[model samples]
Target: MSIEHMEQMETLLPEWLETSRLRTGQGEVASYIPELAKAARDTLGVFVADSQGKTIAAGDYGIPFTMQSISKVFTLILALMDHGEEAVFYNVGKEPTGDDFNSMIKLELVEPGIPFNPLINAGAITVSSLIAGDSPEDKSQRILQFFRKLAGNDGLDYNMDVYHSELETGDLNRSLAYFLKQNGVLKDPVEDVLSVYFKHCSIEVNCADLSRMALVLAFDGVDPCNGEKLIPRRYVQIAKTFMVTCGMYNASGEFAIDVGIPAKSGVSGGILALVPGQYGIGVVGPSLNSKGNSTAGVHLLERLSKEFSWSLF
Candidate 1:
């Protein structure tokens, strides 16, 4: 079944990409980050990789971009591995807040005061504090190493241009870290945690890298490409649930309905999605919709999901 689906995808992807690329004009490139504004607004790309390491690609799939918030999913798993579920859950909640991913409104409104889920900025920041490392530098290096293993690409490294830009102008994120610190939710120093957070977000990858990483999650944490268990099955289950509930920020519900898959979207216009037990997909369309998702990328996923009956629900 999976082989047949991959074959069908190879046959049909080009046509689908062309149609989806038309939606790029309806959106705008994110400029608040300064560095992200430089991405080609009209560009659209996608890559799909199966467990066997085979891939089918289209459009600008080779273009490398920062992982952005997509790094949170893996960091959440790393936190779980470091501190265990009980400890990790105490610092982060499991529900979705309809608010923006970067919003701090819910932190004060809600009891226990943790971020709604690990995918959001607040929760991810808290998770960064939980990483088992001696210093911020050490933690960041560990995260890079882990990501490289999952992607099977040793060349993966930080896009320092984006990293320095975000670090310089990330006042809002710094505010969130201070708030978490005030609430006693963040154990590490605010700057230290933020450094780790920003460093991970700056890790760079192209579509193929993302697909390879997602393929590990698709197979219940086993990297089918090399038959290595990179994450526990339980951790992947928890991460995937969060992906469905909150990975797309406030637009998660719409994406779940339209694309019907566990997916995560980063502010840099990269989306990492998976068909459980089947395929892993990576998409990039810098032009974003109002909810901060890739406009053309989301449309393309919707088309493919409907055509392939890939929805889990």
Candidate 2:
């Protein structure tokens, strides 16, 4: 039952889709953000890309959604690349919070304002401030450019509607930024950082585009499409290690045990999971389980990893 030995993985997914799609029936879409609540609850999609940039998918794979927290991975990598690993880690730690993504209790409990990891909202905001740009516009443009390179799609840009929606209700995040500022941990102003952070989160993409972005991490930052070194190799290993250990908020450890793939989950019900140097999978089902991850997503990935024997451990 190894993916390498499986003769027809490309043919098995649709049947799996039919059987697995219904797992989303019981879960609910994230309603915290008014825009996020509008996602089609039953809209399930899966896209996978191999090392050679080949792909296969089923269901609503082409339907577009915001990158949400999944953008954390790319931005973290970009910050590391521009500032060097040592500089970036000074502001963010590599540990998981075991709390909700937007929780603020940590900033008080973990003094001096170091974010536990870049996967969480507080940590992501800290990471965004390290992107090596002096201005918000410069920093955001740099983030989008890096994304375009990894996704092979220059058309990527922030969904203004989602950005505004998030910005309007981002009280907790604003508090987190101010906390960092008080401790001298934040490099940019809170207003500027929020602008960059919100824009990155609002960047739109479908499952296919995300799978390709995962492909960059799969190959350790090398864009296999054109032999371009899109991200530094060491930075990617760091990002992937965090993804495996803490990518799914509080459920990260369980996801690692069950799925055994280096993966990241966004609030938009999208999971970007990849097998290093082999393949990458993108799954989206807007209905979230108690862990704030897609309900069917956790189950489907566990089954796929077990059947295919692709555990990193």
Candidate 3:
């Protein structure tokens, strides 16, 4: 992981951001979540945290936004930490569903009702149930602990408004939860599991916080700042494997081809990416492409990976 370091990529990031923002107009913001759609569509930003803990950024990198689906990565890792790998994988899978990120049809089509991968909403909810907890509050605390550990910030908190908003409008997630319950894949009650899942989805952070979290994964679960292991190595493997395979919903394959890095994206246009064993990258652009990935975020990553040769493959 040793490398020459840039004091800050922020000074040069704006030029890179501007060049990559051309695709924002070609895509639409997510309207399903309602609140997510109201974000400034034209906004695009990039933030990077290297192995040295140096921060760099440009554009709307400071914009506050809910983690949305991006939080699933943390929850999946948390569930793995609570339950062993075998227990986690038994309920969810590592392969991509290739359907929309929010597609319920995949749940119906997959036999025995196992989710195609933990990055999807259905899979994430299933993972949420595996946390060692008897109540929703108990389960959520485990997640918060994991997030705080990785983000290196105890101030990270759930946005109750966003959580309630998703709860009020989450018919699809509710239906998926019930489906998992009926199939015997859910460990907790559907409502309880969904509560934890939605709350994780509603965790709020700006791009800088996200890069710190992403950097943990980039460093293989070790927080470079203190050289401490924040996540188990085995569970880190599972989380990143899923990110490479299913992180961007249906656009994962295309992302792999273009960006050549393991990455995750949310409906809020936040993407967490990495060059494993190297540097972690984060991007935000409220507008999303057809597959619910950040439009400019995609372009920015593609160009960054190309310019820096950051592919894991």
Candidate 4:
């Protein structure tokens, strides 16, 4: 089954990538973060990796970018592992807000005020406060180490330029952290929490790295290449559920309907998606549609899912 999937991907990926890249022009590169806006709007890349580390790739697969909001998925898992389900859920709820990922509207309006889900900016900022560390730097190091382990790449690190850019223009996230603190939902200092959040958001990765990370989740917490369990099964299940329900921001429902996969997208124009027990896929396209997903990347996944019947639905 894996061989057949790889064969189909190798044969069909080039054409699919070309078709998707055509949609890049219709979307705009994210400009709120100055460094993110520099990404080439027309570039598109796709990489699919199997359990054994074999891969098939097309387009700008080697180009590196930050994980952005996609990093939130793992951070939520890390927090769950650190604090367990009951404590973690105390600070964040488990429903989609149907608002912008970074919007603070519900934080103000909702009583007893917890962010709707850990995948949103408000909830992620709250989660960052839960990471086990004595200081913000300590927390950031642990997150980087955790990400490196998941990607099976020891050299993984943050793109500092992007990190600084995020910090400079992150007034909204800062506000979210302060609000969470005021609501007694976050225990850490606001800047410390934001520091941890921004650091993880700037972690650099390419399509291949994301494919390896997704492969672990695809196998339900086990690292397919080493046959080792990297995350608890329950935590993996929770993460995948959020990926299906909220990973693409407001367009998650549309993505689930059209592409039918458990996936998370980043504002850096990258996406991490998986075909459970089958393939781990990664894509990047700097141009974004109104919903903040990679425009070309979403189209490419829709095509591949349709062609291979990869949808969970």
Query: Per-residue alpha-carbon lDDT of model 3 for 62-158, expressed as tens digits?
Result: 8888888889888887777777888888898778787887778877776877888888888888888887887999889878877887888898899
Q: Least lDDT summed over 10 consecutive residues: which range in candidate 3?
A: 1-10
Model 4 stretches astray by more than 4 angstroms: none
Which candidate tops lDDT? 4
Ranking by TM-score: 4, 1, 2, 3
Better by lDDT, candidate 3 or 1: 1
Worst 10 residues of 4 by lDDT: 1-10
Q: Answer with 3 or 4, whichever has the higher TM-score.
A: 4
Off by over 4 Å in 1: 2-4
Q: Flag the better candidate by lDDT, 1 or 4.
A: 4
lDDT of each: 0.93, 0.86, 0.83, 0.94
Superposition error at 24 for model 4 (Å): 0.3
Mind sharing the TM-score for model 3?
Answer: 0.95
Give all TM-scores, in the order shown: 0.98, 0.96, 0.95, 0.98
- For candidate 2, give the lDDT: 0.86
- For model 4, residues 1-313, the per-residue Cα lDDT tens digits are 5567778779988998998899999999999999999999999999999887688999999999999999999999999999999999988999999999999999889988999999999999988999998899998999999999999899999999999999999998988888888889988778888989999999999999999999999999999898989999999999999999999999999999999999999999999999999888889999999999999999999999998898988
